[model samples]
Target chain A: MSEPFRFHTRLNLVELLGRRAGTVRELLTGIREVPGASIYHHTHRFLQQHHFLSPEPPNDFAYWISGSLGLNDIGERLASIDTVRYRRINDLRTRYVEILEEALAARRNSWPVCQESDEFHFMSCRTFIIPLPAVARDAGEFLDILGRISVNSLYYHVFESRLWLERGENDFAVWFEARGDHELAGALARLDPYTITLEGLRQEIIGLVRRHVQDR
Target chain B: MSRIDDYVPVAGASEVEELRLLAARLEGKTIRNVNSTAVGGGVAEILTRMLPLLKELGVDARWDVIKGNERFFAVTKNMHNALHGMDVPVTGDDLDFFVDVNRRNAAEMDLASDILFIHDPQPIALVERKGDLGGKWIWRCHIDFTDPRPEIWAFLKGYIERYDGAVFSAPAFSRPLSVRQVLISPSIDPLSDKNRDLGEDEIDRVCAGYGIDRGRPIVTQISRFDYLKDPVGVIKAYRMVKEHMDCQLVLAGGGATDDPEGLRVLDEVKREAEGDPDVLVLFLPPASDIEINALQRASSVVLQKSLKEGFGLTVAEALWKAKPVIASAVGGIPLQIAHKYSGILTRTVEGAAFWIKQLLQEPEYARKLGVNGREHIRANYLITRHIRDYLLLFLSLYFEKDVIRL
Candidate 1:
């Protein structure tokens, strides 16, 4: 057997950059100038914080643009960015910037501004990834530990590692493919993680892995 | 005194274990929390409950109360009001006295620890001893900084910048400072007396003791008799709701003895509710957590009509009990409510009255809101999450990078 898959989880602490924007123009500047950490924080904050209730929650930019600035058209476009398709934070950020630039061009004369209290405060987070006690030596052991691990551990493996960390594939799929399970690895890779809740994703993965383990 | 293990069921078992892991990183460090008043305010209450859990997690946590005279408190009180944008008169001498009091407390107390966490404006000046103490200092501001008085903010800014970092209850409270600023929202202990689950018998007995009838739908606002809480606006909203249906309003809280303005506001509320029999005005004594819990549980709709607020933990408390809440979108109240998802957020007295009437008329919708609200509080506003954030914050100070692998 290959090396064991070490399960790791992260604890994130959010910090306010003390920069705020009331208009789309200012938001564009912030999206361009702020570090990638700030961009990651805004896009993925709700997923980490509200893992239990997930109806494909919108990013902070979409939420503020629609709810506060009354720009549902551009907000919807931003929300439909297909986060799973982007393999890196810079790519996701570039897409957001492009959307805002188009919005700016279309509404050059009629730009709306949010109230002073309603401005979007830019924030970033620091994360500490620590090893959990759980490790899986084989597919059966991986399936067993997947059901009981914290949602945070699952999130780090599936979402954070796949997209923002630019790993090209989720850790589980990578592990499976390395173990010569091409069919199961492809199946896990095809799943769209953004559309489902964290727990829902866990169940789906468990079902797929269970079928493979039983067939073996 | 509920132990850390007692919160395992409330906050999931996995989360409790996760907190232990986060605390393990800071196993040998000592964290000293300095605040004013061992009783009464939110900071003290949180420290009282949190110190033991932190210690149980193997972090040597201790709390120290800064000493101050009544005159010093008065000056600091004015400073506090001024920081909230109120035009309170505070002279230069008063500022000097505030610093002098902190200097005296610094001399008397043991200022040695790996982390010195100073809470609020009273002990803010204690940062002056950082050179002698030689440790990381963090100032946790628990107030709204939307529009602070310039003179008072200028005075505090000098001291605030001297610290290694600052913590604000909400993003709105953060000021543009040179030091690092983190956003850490305040939390409610679910196992605490004010938030613990009460039996139907205890709830009914407490309501009966307060002369409340369980037959009518009850609307409650649990806050002190302060103008910022907008107790009078609450009565106005309740009267508007009363015009539509048969409902009762409960305004219950204490701690009005020290503030003369609180006494005046209490009297004004009485006059406004003089002829209304359904309006029950309760000025409960301190340590009335069980009564407050019962009042919230018995309430059909909970309200927090604050014109200005810090974080409005009452909203979280009511939501934790799965009760529908209507609160103003000021300060951190917006952080708790998602506007008709978990709970309702209002901007005016009419908006509040409309939601109150709508929720009472529609039972199923109200139930859904309450259920969603409980889940929201379970995920975000519990003390377990707060402790996790603090542990991460303590660890963040030692690492300069955004992502760390340990």
Candidate 2:
């Protein structure tokens, strides 16, 4: 008999949050300590203010685990993870490191630093920072993270898979490889950092306004 | 009766009017004109300006373009190259395609006029439809057909025999065809944007925009981006002249939509002029008439170094501006420019460079040549004279005259 086809679900927010729990915890705490800290404080306040202890049933395994541990308690659980699972994660990380090394080597040898301003800068490290208002901090962080992670990872995954053997795939491969260059990726990485700081500052102002509202 | 004032004449307006009056004697006759294109070429440009003038003279003059799709055009383009003495393959399929397109155009077009004029090879097959609509058909060839490919000529001769007469631009371009052939050179409209006088400010502005120094000696040629124009040869001549005389060359022209080989030829030209700072290779758009006029006016000497020319209008345009021209003594150029009198004629790059250096050295001689050239154009190659010739030719079909006394 023919083997049955296996359909795998894509990795979601639950998997990503669980995998990088320590980093997320450290980022969240650093944001909350600063009042009037721009977008950073607002981002932490939004994460901490969510009703994790609500009586509603958790949607999935990652949500249930997250709720049990609480948002502030993720760093300790990540540290206490079993050795076998940690080893597997390390192996995946090493594979990613090798792919990046190969790309860097290719870039160093072949690519020229694009000098013509008239032509589109396809592989440049230029970043544009947009100032976000204090009130729309959580919404801003959500959008900023969504834009950077989804687009950049999608670009990197396409190049790493080498899906360029098909007839029409060359154009797509060129576009993704251009976007996933080190300079372009570095520019995109700074977007999340600036977004997080702006979000934090927005929340502190909102809290002060709320206290004024209650007293009145 | 239609008056001559209704028509816009470029030159020799009075003589044209006199001829039109003579043509009015034969009032009821119909006159027809056949040519390759109704746009982009000199034949089309002349016919567009001349047809109305003829109609206003009480002679019925109509113009027609030969119909051809991309494949037919490609074959005809090869035929064009072959007729210029290039050894190109004119396959049976190419002839078949040419005949098929002509037959199709003949079916759709009305060929019932009294005097039918067939322009070039593209519409030469329309003479096959002459049995049903009998008239005096004239084959007006605007190209050098002295050494056409034998196979292609044999095929075209079957249609050429049907014509009552043939017209050639130059005596050299003529071959011993069965029909009676006449020589009538092409002319230019002095009032047209490419030849008309521009204000000093407008000329200055255009020169500034293109980074052309108005004070420096500018040598220019304005023709379509075709191999026959020999833009690369113009650069060679310019470089040779630059050895002694400090001058800049402007190779300014546009490509027509009908010519498929234009882009490839332009790319080859750009490759040849890789690092030449003094050479300005401008690929002007079709609508750049004023800019062309400005360049010609600003030029110290105008050159048309065509390897093979049907009729280089740039010679007439420069002459109309009273600028001394150094043109190749090929095709219709000799008809316009009389060597050392009206303009200097040359055959090779060395000859052209020699004349350019001479003209730069002696301003008085160059100025006198320019003066003689303007009067020559005024006497022979103006649109007025061209319109008068057609009017007279149309009238002659009905009435036989020993000499046309316009």
Candidate 3:
């Protein structure tokens, strides 16, 4: 129903190491804002096993980041230090987070400003990934924003999200109700995702969103 | 239970009667289904099974396949991938050829019926006849449209909007269309040759013919030899599993009549599978249902490693046989497998390999998943339920003005 979330920073570890932070410690300090544990473990295991065979550079966090985030290109050419030098798990974590940011950054530029579709399925290869700075004022603005783009764009942003699906519809529905959109929340609860057509449901939702948008 | 009466044992008499009552209500309406291919793929298969049953239930139903040449089919194939968001480059020539082919077919074929049902984009343009012709045209999009390429979708959207209604396999498969849209997930017939019960000897015989030893832990993917199915990815995952356990891989499938790229993809798969004696690449002939049924029953684990899929029937087929299925969590696959409950949904080759190895290592857990999987299929995926849903859809269209006094 959806794709992985877009990470914030775009620090290409390979390029960063090659240019700004050659040592793992400096790279760790640079990417400290991004937590390491969230995405590093799986990338670490993949690197531990397939890093040598993969085109992703071994010494830098770029390989782990690129591979983990499904990015097609190997990360930047920032020369990397030996992983043996940093024995602590936090060192690995920071590298992973840094590499993730690098890939995410690359993915953002990979497509058109208003993307028609996703290619490479890397960091920015998601459906409803609009970085909402704040919640919508009402249903109208929300629907207007959602409808401004293609239907696919509207889908991932609110309804068919992986995070929402994983947490179950009730939690999402409750959140919707709390946002003062009870009419939309009730409609969501009534429809079965498997059997309902988004066409019919979206019409109703857009109608409601438009109603609110005009109200303001 | 191969007959309509036979379904009573599994679906229960009352449930079958409900379908019967719905069919009875739809009795006078003539339902005509039009598609691109008649022999290969799921839409054809489902129609083949359902049309006759619909006729038996007293609703006049017919199936027709549109006419197209080699170039037209090739374009449609590309269109199929593009619709599924495969990033394939589809040009103006492709779109023109597709429309030209559909125009010719529309001129030739009699698309007349009370309800004219069009399946997928292959024959979607046929819906353009709705204005000249009089009928409730239902555009049944069986392929995944979750992330369709913008240009291709824009081209198809014109004809699609003309339909009285649309049917998607899942809500995610839907887009913002003006037509009334409903979700009707495709289903497999429990009493069909491809899904019916088979003896142990029959299972052994099918495995023996393919040189697949049934004793070993077998991970099989039953699908068309298309790139979208990712036979190469399945091999990669199989190799990963082989590194851990002494398992065998079976990539068994045949090409559809409509897909010209099948042979080239088959060659690519063979090249990818070269030098691996454990890998069994079987090109089964069409209608080899007994062989297909036997393979699913014989395998310890069934895999559907599709890069993009439109409700992989093979996944449902294997689950109906109560085999532990590990499939890509794309399209309608996740809707079938509940992840660690009925079956497992994997994202990558490594992830698929991990689950295959886990299932092979723990027979008890695999068996448990299979048991749960059978129940899930029984409740959700069998043909009887599909018939009921379709009948209801047809009746709903006809009875929209009424409050259901039937």
Candidate 4:
């Protein structure tokens, strides 16, 4: 099996972080300094920089944010931020933790997230979930990307891969592009062997995710 | 009546009028349909098309979608598989979750339709709310219920008895229900965008757009990304035929809104067809009706090799276009294909492959089969027939007499 395609041209995490430091600093400062702007904007912009958010407006920010940051905090934060109501930051912190826990709960039981069968032409019923390793290693990035893609799209791509790994070829680029994470796509190409079988890649992904999760 | 005539050419204007008259007899009566989702699966597709027609017929038809989070849907999805004879372990929590969601939906929805039609097992428990609703409720089982998980079936039987009657697509799907059972097979709307006749140029343009070769014989199967559709089996059959004949296989389909198993099935299919140059697997959207119609019409032979099927509408759609289809002898497919007379029926990959090779080799036989298949569909499976049957069914519930000659 050929190495999976890598989305990033360079694998240096430090270099990538350095290049993205300005945006990350802007995001952090925006949340801390801006009186009216909430962390939602900062998180969204950070996600967008990582190719998780689309260039289009209303890119599933609510669900991802709500999923990542408990629903109550999101509602309160959005309300306070937009309405300029002075709310304690501690409340926001508590809500964020609650949301993360909920998301984690969803992640735990939502294992093997199946896609709708009517979306594509494939044979076996399949599903996908973010490997614990992948999630732990890049929780923020994962959440950012998760926020951008519709629930249906996420399910569809994952399910498609489960049914026919070759279908992976169809969406590997698009899935990353949608998340604004071309680096991952590049990483896949580099890791994937040209003549590799679908099962081999799936196993590799599963193993990587398991190891990543274990490391965390 | 005029509406039917405008949309369906097979139904005589008078026949359609009779249907309208029957429908008018039931006017002002509330008819509710309970199902899993409002989009994706065939039940949703059929309802989306049928509900408006029922409304046009002066019946107060409404659709209700059951609510479920991912865990709930996952359980129901497993129940669906279990009902189809798959050995899925339905945990006690799964059952509890199923009832919990159904109970919630039952409480939320106004279950007051004069004729309450419950589709499949997903919302079967909604029938539990039948107490003093002062109306007849019908359980419409769309999937193959001939062999179901005994526990699931037994649990569902309690709810089934609450309904006034039950509807099944095939006799095989019917079980020993306490309530009366009505066998009403599914139908295809020949007049719909997905089944309408396209101009030769339009067909050519669609074929060109899909990069499907016009010079060779085309075998197509358009279905959802589900294992029951047996897309991988279709590829294997196509490969077998390719050994002797020069043809192309186009597996074109899309996902539905409610199904959570589509993407995985699609991926598995793609892996199985690796390095196959002649096979074209298309992940089309639900709205690609015209494309589907064009693919069916362009093809010399169509295949629907389903391991199990509620009703393979693609088979009817192909036959409506007078294309010979070879389908698995499962679910509602046998209702459409009458063996060697209308279309070929196969049980295994070898059987399917044999028929595909035979059809490709014998043009005359294939042509006759296509002709017979088209007439069979025209006679029984068209939307006109479907509308008429439904109208009659609605009237029969009131009349109770079988000898109502049209």
What lDDT would each prediction earn against the true structure? 0.89, 0.58, 0.66, 0.62
lDDT per residue for candidate 1 within B1-406, as digits (tens), equals 8788999888888889999998888987889999999997778888888988999899888899998999999998888889878899999999888889899998999979999999988999899989988989999888778899999989999999999999998888877899999999999999988898899999999999989999889999999998889998999998898887999999998865887988998999999899889999998887899999999999999999998888889999999999999998888988888777788988799999999999999989999889989988998999999999898888888989888887
Q: Top DockQ: which candidate number?
A: 1
True contacts kept of 1: 0.80
What's the iRMSD of model 3? Answer: 22.1
lDDT of 3 by residue, B1-406 (tens): 2457889887666456656666777767889988888886677878888887878788899888888889988888888878867789789888888888889999999877899988888888887788888989888888778788899889988888888877778545666667666666788888888988999999988889888887788889999898889999999999888887898889999876566699888889899899989998888887789998998899999999888777787898999899999998777776577667678988788998999989999999999889777866776678987887677677767544311334
- The pairs that clash in candidate 3 are A14-A78, A15-A76, A15-A78, A18-A78, A18-A79, A140-A213
Which stretches of candidate 4 lie above 4 Å from their native place? A1-216, B1-3, B256-276, B399-401, B404-406
Give model 4's TM-score versus the native structure: 0.61
**Over the true interface residues, superposed, what is the Cα RMSD of model 4?**
30.6
As a whole number from 0 to 100, the lDDT of residue B334 in candidate 3 is: 61
* Residue range B224-313, candidate 4, lDDT tens digits: 888888999999988888888899889989886465688888888888877877788899975898998899999988999988777777
Better of 3 and 4 by TM-score: 3
Residue-pair clashes per candidate, as listed? Answer: 0, 16, 6, 59
DockQ of 4: 0.01
**Tens digits of per-residue lDDT for model 2, B1-406:** 2235633344333354455455665577777787677787667876777776667666677777766788888888898888877888889888887888888989998878888988878888888888889988888778776567787777877888788766666555555567655556688776677777799999999989999987889999888788878888888888888889788888888886666788777887888777977778888987899999999888899999887776777788899898999998666676577567678988788998899999999999999889778877776677766665555455445533322222
| Candidates sorted by TM-score, best first | 1, 3, 4, 2
Interface RMSD of each: 1.3, 43.1, 22.1, 30.6
lDDT of 3 by residue, A1-216 (tens): 122222110001000011122333433344554333222322332222121122222432454223223333534432243332333546655555665456445535442121112111111011112232224444544554444433323333333332222333432344566766677667655543322233444565666546644665
In candidate 3, position B361 carries an lDDT of 92
